[model samples]
Target: MMMKKGFLLKQILWISALIFMFGCGSEEQFEQTASGLEYKFHIKNDSARPVQLYDIVEVRMNYGTHDSVLFASGNQTIPFQIDPIYEGDLLEGIMLMHLGDSATFVIDTEDFFVKMMQSPQIPDYADGEDKLYFDLKVVNIITETPAVKARRLEATERKLAEEKTIADYVEENNITVAPTESGLYFIPITEGNGSKVKNGDAVKVHYTGSLLDGTVYYSSFDRGMPITFVAGSGEMLAGWEEAILMMKPGGKARWIVPSSLAYGSYEREGVKAYSPLIFDVELIEIVD
Candidate 1:
């Protein structure tokens, strides 16, 4: 009986050692950081600078569990600005990485779901597991500055001409369409087909923009080139985005953009503050 007990103990220890050495092979390389995070460096660039606070970062990211993928930024080259949700979370892990570094950070499923995601409970699909692996490759990090955030030059005197000028133009042009709930007037000249425009869609458009006083500021027609901007990406003015969202491919519309929807209270290039804008816009293509 003593010899049998000794043999069992030896077998248990041997198996434990084998699992520790070879179970996942790379398990030894992972280092614990924070309370519930673990990370391993597959590629590290010692010369590159680490990410800083409020810096906009472009990352090729795919976060998932052992068996399933939850979300992926597929072929989207758009950058994500990092703001830490907690003291020791995924954003902090990202801050630890340098440019061109490839690493994998393991996050707790409970922390991800309950804490960060604000879900009621861990989902049934991740029932037995408590870790979500984020395979990240730090692409580019842009330092945050006021110039990049708000490009305001100087506060200009308010003219308050937007409302009256837009009203006058609409009356003169025989435009008769009720304004939308957000105080935007979109008059369609041609109908389009397919899905309604939403965020993350690359849309190509041809536009001619002018002040209500008939001063043309910018036009794609004169340049002989169409401009493309992502929908809901803040690449264009609010009035432009709102009107384009109501359009589809091969559609054309006239948008009367008040200063509130255009550049409000700040003088911009070739346009005065509080000025109403008129745009003849055509949606040339919608790249999915």
Candidate 2:
């Protein structure tokens, strides 16, 4: 089968753009951290406040390989907690900085995509010896250390915190939409004219899943592709199964999944037990 010229052109342009974005950094002046990650400080601040664990830091970040620019968040300030989810994660890069500091980090490409992004498989473009680069500038930092917040690890405390967290978020964000019976907020951001998703239908979707605090756990965009799966299959979280059923091809929505409908009591390297999650999904199509 012949590929369409327009699609082929887009693919070529995407590849070119990916390859053109990152700088071939010099190893000189780079310092190695205990975790095997290397970093170079472009701009450093000595007197400003330093980031601590659980602190919510706002930073301008763009990450990619020396050849490919994967995800460049444009001029946007992203706020996330300073907890390390995986070895050599974004946390490691942020921890070694103070307010107003700008730095570039060199980390293992496979470790980042496999451990941090939780990508099913590494993208072919990022599967080589070139390391991943993360350029970040600290904009703001709120010191919310576990001790400062008096956090507890008990499941009972977690249950209460989970409910309050959702409630506070909804109230502050002015989210007036009601949630489903399972406490899943199934709100559509855009409408779709295509066929509605059915149980056995094969569908492809682009989604970014994060914790309630803007910490992205997974993003298909970062992977430079979408994910395909059969609807209602147990491959997805329970919240996704219910939310995707309400969407159609071309539709986009946000789902606020409570811990009850999410990974309740399921802890892992990158996941916390009974953690609430948010998924921003774009249903691409219902496969033929």
Local distance difference test, each candidate: 0.66, 0.69
Best by TM-score: 2
Per-residue accuracy of model 2 over 1-288 as CA lDDT, tens digit each: 011122211211111111222365467657888777788877788888988887888777666767656665555565665667666666777889999888877878766644454332345556665587777788888867665455425544777689888988889888999988879998789989766898879888998888888998778878878988777544555577778889988999999998766655444334576688888999999998
Cα RMSD of all models vs. native, in order, equals 17.4, 12.8
Residue 24, candidate 1: alpha-carbon lDDT: 46
Could you tell me which residue pairs clash in candidate 2?
Answer: none
Candidate 1 Cα outliers beyond 4 Å, as residue runs: 1-158
Candidate 1 CA-lDDT value: 0.66
- lDDT by residue (tens digit), candidate 1, 1-288: 101112211211110100111124365678877554678776799899888876877776666665566545554434554656565677778888899887777778777654444333455556667777767777778886786444322222334444666777789988889988767889899988887678768988888888877898889878888888777654456677678889989999888877667655434467765677788998998985
- Poorest 10 consecutive residues of model 2 by lDDT? 8-17
TM-score of 1: 0.45
Residue 205 error, candidate 1, Å: 0.7
Model 2 has an lDDT value of 0.69
